[model samples]
Target: MALLWSRISSILPPNEEQFPLQFSDKVESSVVEMLKRSRRQLYCDTTSTSRMLNAQIVVDISWERLNTGTWRDVDKEWRRVYAYGCLFKVAALCRENPSEDEVLQAVRTCDMGLLMGAAIMDNILQVLVRILQSELRKTAKDEDESEHVEIKRAKIVSPHVPSIKEDLAIPRMKCPSLESFNTNHLIPLKPVILEGIVDHWPALNKHPWSIDYLRSVAGCRTVPVEVGSRYTDVDWSQTLLTVNQFIDRYILNKDQTSQDGGKPLGYLAQHQLFDQVPELKEDIRIPDYCCLCEGDEDDITVNAWFGPAGTVSPLHQDPQQNFLAQVVGSKYIRLYSPEDTDKLYPHQSQLLHNTSQVEVENPDVERFPEFAKAPYLECVLQPGDVLFIPVKHWHYVRSLEVSFSVSFWWS
Candidate 1:
């Protein structure tokens, strides 16, 4: 396909204005025939052939192909490419679930983001989303009572408030050894910044983990990205996009506004991204500090945090001790001792009990007056800094720039 596209590009007019409309009718017809053959070969059940024949098409795109076209034209082609990318991803998903029934089931649960992102066609995207949603609803109605109970639990919500002072700061240290770290901080449940701990990590080098490098290697891997003011916000939601799309829309084009007028923060938070893309794991190292554990190496949970500046993690506590290794950009981290539990009011909602209700940056002090007195230790973690956060220590984190951090959690 690359070779064919290259040949086509060479014959095309160099001036963008003279180039033809982007729609390739031949390619579209060929794609349809391919889908038909795939359905026939995979599901030989004659009774279901008609439904497969009429399967709803999610992508039918037309736009200007040349660079001289308006921004709208460029955006149109972008969506077309994204839609094709998603179709390939859907095939991958189906391959993962080889059985015919399971493949169809997986497609029913696929979200709108996989079908389209920044596509400028919200009306069409809405129609596709509703189709999937309707299928999921029907599936739920057909499920047993146990499944219904589980679904209901996910919908339930309860609210609570937390308290934490905005002005306090967390403590910092420089490269404390394993022995000194355990004696001075770990055993005491103290939150301390350990600088120079990640200086040797490959991610700190100039080339491999750069934006261009990451896009080249892991670009096609689709991962869930958070889009919102913060995870705790009522409007928060998750969307799927390729790493290349993420870098293009959120990282490279940081200043441009989305269809929604607001500049929503895009966060790839707390995902075991290294597990999903092992190549990325090569860029990071498991700090020796995690070796303090008596169990096997698997006891440690490694999560990647990548996002643009302005992404916020509401005050929350984790179950295991954490070493948050900063690789790129900076983050403002604020920590409160576990002893201030009552002062730092936790949410009453079961799902968010570990999360605080207070927005640390701009607290509603009048409503949660005790928040004004709750002491918090704060620090801006720079590249190569690893912040040790003891279990159950209330911490509020916000990205100070386009940032990427690897967090190691162990019992």
Candidate 2:
């Protein structure tokens, strides 16, 4: 055992020591300034910063100059260096903060997990958090005042958007037959509400998924959550938090102000949550209509949409046919056919081509005059309702209450 330990120690790099090394004033100051600047850049325009955070940093290296397989080795070595580099940046940002709570928040930034997942899994994240906490306490004691003023606690304002009484021109039926729904809606790329479709699902009554029930079942489980009201917002970001932490901070901690000066809205959107929490899958049954798809019913993709009120999925279209089952609360859904693609003004970026650039509720007529001519279908999906949205049908969804929805996508 002693010989094995000695060999392992000899092979490791000096920087990979068992304990962290102390940095000189010059080194620490430079790293601190760089980290602060990086933080400002990161939040300045989150969409661009997200790309910067996750984009691979490539180093120019000629394979011709190295021996066979040596280039591969060099690539792997640099990749590992890149990962550590990200962790160091995160740690520096955390350490420079005078508030312990702010330090924790910095570590919880949505892209941080993507940037430093390997470090977190290796317990390096815990070490960094502890170091940051220690440094923050020391700084607080040394300085007579905090670096910035903290907001006083207040009541959490409701972020819910009240539903408008608009004419819903779409068809709404009570548990329509699979054949009729497929022929009348699916084949024609139309949207329809099939009420009572999910009435038998345990989630509706037999096994209700209330806040207390969710906390009791999967409280400590870590899941990725959206931190802003809508993805289209400039400040929108993602973060990994436990079910309990999400409920406490976003659901229970209403006094907290969001970056947009509104209540922070956390949403667990478009995630294969049933796969993560298998127990929850048993609560809801797959709609029989899913069998109509060309592929096997089991092959259908299932996702969970759980979030507080006001959470929105900006006007977007999915590539596959979707069965959105509303189990708890209600959501306002608006749809437009693919034929209106030109009028809707889809985003120029290929990545977001499926999404619309217009804000449906409040469109800038001068900027998007054509948008007014596009005919749209609307509906309020209540509990026990399953909405059939045909493939490539542009749709916008917004939660009206503390909501839980399950979506199934298939060809």
Candidate 3:
């Protein structure tokens, strides 16, 4: 054993013992200035910040919860309390002291500060989701525990818009046909899909750098993930597929293989894509954010798909906030935590860093008992809808029908 250990050590190349996560003084100063500017904007356009916060959700996590019960009297307080603690502390720095005009101008001019604000709001979105889901589970559990409790039928709700085809007419839209939702759309849908600062752009004809149709047109190496397979959730031996038939025959069954309930769908693993696309580069603007670190070429090999009435994308967090825009079909998103490591059931080793450990629908508390402790927020995105995924939050996606989403990092 000693000889083997020595040989292994010898074969390993000497490298930096540790890479510190240090921010340069300039970056730190820039963050502080941006925070200040954000506060000014908050004072001027109180609702603008509010609306952005409503656009999405974020989470601040740590590996503290492992048992079924509370920890040091704080766990009983709920996860929201912990995440907000992080958000307010960060936001407060920007609001130290502000004059009315300066605050307004700062709000108007502070784009970078909005990133912090967006993150803060993202935390709120997470907390709300956790609490609401917790309450639902509590109520359900309580009802189950009770004897002879009354059960009522769920209420049906109607929509304000006549149909998907109808336009949202407003005084701002004298010509309803040309009316655009702009940013205000995310507000009404706040408790749903979008939970952070909402931004919109005219839909592009295709992904900025994705090669979506290649698999359909070419032959590529592929790995088969069969139903009931274990630890097969994220295998990425495929370089490309011959066509949709190849996926249907080989990949669809992999859904049942999971450490928790079942593995959710994932794009081609980063390693598989990166090895083939060395020309791929890190995103120049947000280099630190990409999950694959493939720069602009990530979409070339990272794209994934799902069939109708199926589940994919088990709850997991990544390094980047994905700009997940749907082009073909609709799907549902349920998100989890960055720090709630125990509940999500992270992979046992180093590769865990690259994948979320959480399972998809049909969560089984018996095996992954701690999963019941994790809180989640959900949204259903349709064609042309976009979702911004902050780093390290667990998310599960269920396809309503044949679905195609183009996911890319925004630097």
Candidate 4:
């Protein structure tokens, strides 16, 4: 069996000596084993035996041979290669449970970005999906006992009227600390980003059968491009996961808790959710694949992920630092300096200090009149862009399209 380098040759640059895969960089043990074998047994010569399926084709891809130092640039080149070979399109790939040959296949196809990000995506997806399945099973049994119980629907918080910015004053305080935000341990504020962050697990790449399974089984669909035209100019629907599947499969289960049925926010840095997911754990794996790396990760209750068309998180400050990353789509964010919290609105009720929940699109000037004077710091984060939101900085997040993201907060 000889190497099937012809098909992938176009994708690999001629210089392959600069980017040898490091053990830490490799996604799976099997792929690494095969690559190691190729060099030792056949002088890095790939063969048909290396092919995982009836596709007895192999190719030598020496990442080391490439002269480029910047992977970002290298990725741009590889993207063109995939496009030329008709292997280009946006699709999900799992990083865990990949077969030996399948792992090899990914090594053949993936460049730096996909290879790295896919691993994280695969692990997160398994946990999230598994949790959803568990929730569904619990709900199904609950339905059997009482067939007429209403299945709670996720709240559509941004459909009718645009929330108005409230007239709450930003507290005039020091640069900032948790003390300013939390009073008697009652969290005054929490930050959340609604974005789909999928990891590239081995199962997704090796098992060619997973595409339809993930798309259909998960009831995944391309997100809507427009909700009501309150977002960016790009088509964002294609990036979001079909969350309805999680509802049908997991929220309906009998073993699930009622609280679990509601919208979930943030990531859990645990792998007890799935046997396979645990095998693929990596260092610094963010729960939801989007953990806020700032200090004090635990004890911060980030309870919501709002992603409706025309949905806008009102200008408010949070107690903890925030890390917001866009996985599937994009979002437009605006922030005000802490000193100017007065220009934005601080809650008189204190219940709404951080999250005004006030309709920004439509405001009752008499009740929340101070909102009109706040200055805003705005930026839009495209896929993979991360925005760090400091505490007490009044900010608003709006979807430019059918957007998705994961946000983390720390006190």
Candidate 5:
């Protein structure tokens, strides 16, 4: 207990004033009290069981309030309460024999706090999460080496090829210069497939984004996943799951069937995952082409798209320029110009106005007669390829196999 206390103390601020500027005086005082109570319990010669039980009771009340209120309406102070509750839980567990699951719970709790809580408080929780992750990694590595065990790798699925006309294909360029790209594509609002630009990324060569490697690095981290078929479907919904659980049920399970004997697709789409697990961020680099935009580098938004072969992103348009980089497997994509907006039937509702009501693969020619005459371009994106999509260009994407892609969006 003393050793654990020493390690945690080193990470904590020396005084309340050193806490994040966003923290109120009341929250600071509450944190100081909790830390004092924990320190006494760890250092005293005799254990005070009643003090620990009282702390648990306080945490329970906070948890109930947090679960009851509407998420956006809930007071921010409740996040602080829940975050400290998790810290106290970790302190209690460390006082006795603790299992690996107990430690993982601590890491997950901190991650949740960061996800839902105020970003200003991230400095404290992010460091705590790193410490817990390091301990888990070290323990797992030691156990593996001691047993001399070998982990079996999963087989890669083959990509599905689609037939298309060569005349309507998107033009391809091999690492065009910044000036040339601006003159040919950016100014004209054209789409093009770029090669040789992302071949040097570590995710492509040095530390290839294989299934096993992703599982090893981020299996335990919690992430939100989209469930059901495509987002346009009536049954579509979202749920949270650990990275390992998602891989096991969605990626590894060949049948891709749900427990209720129905087929449901799971997609980890449009998530800023690099912010959650910084280690994975080191494997990829931002393209220098983003400099053309008039903003700081931090203004760019990066998102990860990972799922099985049949996953589909319905035909929709984005307001910003996009560079979709494929790190593994392949995808078949189709694009329509914004000028043909009336040709494709876009939904009337504000929520889905950007998404077309017509399903490109199985369109109703009678209901949407103009759609048949809409001119478009198509391409099959391969690994290490980056496709530049102009702003407001209606694009549709379908993964050809078990795939992972990262997208960069900027003005």
Candidate 6:
């Protein structure tokens, strides 16, 4: 317990500057006082639980206020509240004789703070969480290697799907030179699949992204997952689940129905999972092609797409160029030129203006007559393939099997 406390305390910012500089002194002082009060309560034998619940009430009020504001307009005080709550949970767990469940609860608290709080004040929480993650991983590894028990993995049966025709396939290149790629694809704003480029990525070789490996590293971390067949569905919603829970429920037991007795699909789509789990991020590298963009290299956005077979990303056009790298499994992708946007029938609402209402695989020809006339290039992206999608190119993606893909978006 003393060693753990020392490690956690080593990561904390100076007492004089605990919060971000943008926050008012009032906010900093208030949060500091709250932490001091919580620490005192935690050390007290009679009032620890009651005081912790009261502190939680205060944090909940700030959380509700945080949700009421727009994304860019969120109040900074709410971040302080979340950070304080995480610190309180850490203090509670550092107390003598904490249970495994209590340690996990502390980890979850820190994760939630990272998910919702400002990054500027998250150093302490991040370090604390990583230390706990290492401990959890070691425990899991020990359990797996224990001689008293046997560990077995369930047999995975992949569903069969028809092969796509290659007559109108996207052009494929094998590690073309920068000048060649720029002249042939970038300048012409054409899509192409580049091979031999990502072949050396650790994700494809040294640190292959196998199910068991992913579970061992990130199984305990919580992540946001989309629940439904597709985002365009009326029933679509998002929920947070631990990586292991998601794997067990969605990847391993795809045939099982949801708790509500309905077959609900789970897709971990368009998430900055790398930011949450740095170990997974180390498996892949940003392609050199991204340097051709006009914006600063740091402006590039990386997103992860992982889900079971049959997951779909409805036809949509992004505002920036994208390099969709296939690390595991395969996907059937279709791309339409921006000139055919009207034929794709983008949704009228501003919220969905970038998304086409028409389903690429099963379109209603009568209602969307122009879609049938829309000429598009298609391809089957195999493992280690990097597909370059030009800006504003309408694209649709469907996983052919359980898959994990990384996309880098840059101007």
| Deviating ranges (above 4 Å) for candidate 3 | 1-231, 234-240, 244-311, 353-358
lDDT string, candidate 3, 280-384, tens digits? 222112212233333464343333343323546556566654656564556767665576767777667785555555455677668788887776666666665
| Clashing residue pairs, backbone N/CA/C < 3 A, model 1 | 162-345, 163-345, 169-377, 169-378, 170-377, 170-378
User: Candidate 5, residue 187: CA error in Å?
Assistant: 1.9
- Candidate numbers sorted by TM-score from highest down: 6, 5, 2, 1, 3, 4
Please write out the lDDT profile of model 6 over residues 1-411, one tens digit for every residue.
335655665665535334333445535565556655665564446454666675675467557757885867877766766666766666566555455666677777778877887654546677777887876655554434431221123324454654666778899999999999999999999999999898878888997887777877788888889988789989999999888788878876644864346677898875558877888888888898888989876799999999877888999999999999998888989999999998999999999999999989899999999999999999888899999999999999988778899999998
Cα distance off (Å), candidate 4, residue 146: 33
Best by lDDT: 6
TM-score of each: 0.61, 0.62, 0.36, 0.35, 0.85, 0.88
Best by TM-score: 6
lDDT of 3: 0.37
Tell me the spans in candidate 5 whose CA falls farther than 4 Å from its real position: 1-6, 14-85, 91-97, 120-122, 141-154, 254-261
The segments of candidate 2 whose C-alpha lies over 4 angstroms from its true place after superposition are 1-167, 258-260
RMSD of 1: 18.6
In model 2, which residue pairs have backbone atoms overlapping below 3 Å?
A: 110-238, 156-254
lDDT (C-alpha, whole model) for all candidates: 0.62, 0.63, 0.37, 0.37, 0.77, 0.78
- Each model's Cα RMSD: 18.6, 13.3, 25.3, 18.5, 4.1, 3.7
Candidate 2, residues 253-338, lDDT tens digits: the string is: 54575435666588887554665455688898889888888989678998998886677888999899999999877888889999
In the range 261-303, model 5's lDDT, one tens digit per residue, is 5678899985557888887888988998898987878989999
Worst 10 residues of 5 by lDDT: 145-154
The window of 10 residues in a row where model 3 has the poorest summed lDDT is: 150-159
Across 203-271, the per-residue lDDT of candidate 1 in tens digits comes to: 887453555456544554567888885888778998877675777677655446742567676888755
